[model samples]
Target: MTNMTFSEQIWYGLFKPSKYKELVESRKSRSVLYILVILLVLGLVTFVVPTAAIITGFGGMNKLFSETMAPVAYDGNQLTIEEPFRMNVADTVFILDSTYYTVPDKELERDGTYIAVGSKNVRMTTIIGGEKWMDNITPIEQVLAPGFSNDSLVDMVPAIYVSLFLCYLIMCLLYFVKYGFLALILSFIINSMNKQMEIGLSFGQVYMVCFYGMSLGMLLTNFNIAMGLISPMLVSTVTVFVSMNFITMAMVSMRKGNQV
Candidate 1:
């Protein structure tokens, strides 16, 4: 810690957690730096990586939408699709008119996303992702000639970007809260062990170690996922146990036989 810079300590904490005691002793600023670096790493792994994958997988969603989804004529009162078509749910848009009707697209019912045009109240259902959103649409001020407009599909990019960003931000905060809570519990255990060993380390020091220790657990969980060795349902539980174990190992390595 005396010789290493703040950025160096961050790398050390991730790869060499045994140096945590020395790192924690130098300056409280190290704690803040470590936290910011950890969060940045987590954000890159969880958000940035997935976002890149999605962008690559879609291969220009706007272009795809423009080429595919187009408005088709339907009864003003109702639009029904009984067959699967290339222009399925994502491409289908029901234009609102004087007639209030029901849409029953068998293809959409099986798997698709349908949009009700000219109304703020719209039902968006995705069969594959198993997500449903209902809202009164208020954006379209005029009724078009009762057909799908590729421009409408292309125009949705900004809203989708905003929604995705908000969701990512919320998820990051939730993860921080969850990880911090678990780290605090692990810190309590380390504090008790410190007392037993006659070590004088404070709870703050142990808590910082717990947070840094979490990086190892997060990395391991990511590795296990990439290797397809663990199920998504078990990741949180496994992460907690793994992170706690890392903290325990750090405590033992950093202080042995009353050496703090």
Candidate 2:
């Protein structure tokens, strides 16, 4: 059995696929479990820096709402604002104009105004992967809670943060499921390949190989998310490519009886 620590194993896993033969031969399923747990923890920790940046940036949001936003009132029937509010960020626009109940499709497409609030109702457009979604309209009464007012806007920031934290947890759970499923599929493929080559790898051993091979991909995915550097689809595509490449290299090394 190899005397490598978990951290050393991870390093070798990324930079030295030939080392996988020795790692697999070690038969330390407990080490594999430790690696999986460490990966999950690292995934969650990746959000901390970005979350801190967002929290620090809330000062600007507070200023925007407190200073730029006019006092607004939403009665049971109609919504009223003293003045229109507009802000544009990159490809997205936010608008609060009480005159028009609905925005024209042509204008929305041209201006990329995904959110528009008016007197009677609020119209929202969602776009994903360059596809424009249908507009969702909600009556003003339904949009605003009974006690919602301009004065309470700042107070709601904490609740929004709480909701975001909850969303992060949900995302982590989904990622865990996705990672496990992908590893299982890869293990199956590797095991079948090994059978044809007479390498005689068990499912458990192949699974451990997949777990280690996918580490770099998981790190890249989390880094992309924290940086917001690419689209979600692009991130997923890159992750799969990187992971498969590493797995292939590791399996090849195993077949050749390579070691660190």
lDDT of 1 by residue, 59-142 (tens): 655865555334423333333223212422111333333122322333245433355432222334434454444433333323
Q: Which number leads on TM-score? A: 2
lDDT, candidate 1, residue 195?
77
Judged by whole-model lDDT over C-alpha atoms, candidate 1 comes out at 0.59
The CA lDDT of each predicted structure is 0.59, 0.69
Off by over 4 Å in 1: 68-148, 222-242, 257-260
Give the number of the best model, judged by lDDT: 2
Score residue 214 of candidate 1 by CA lDDT: 85
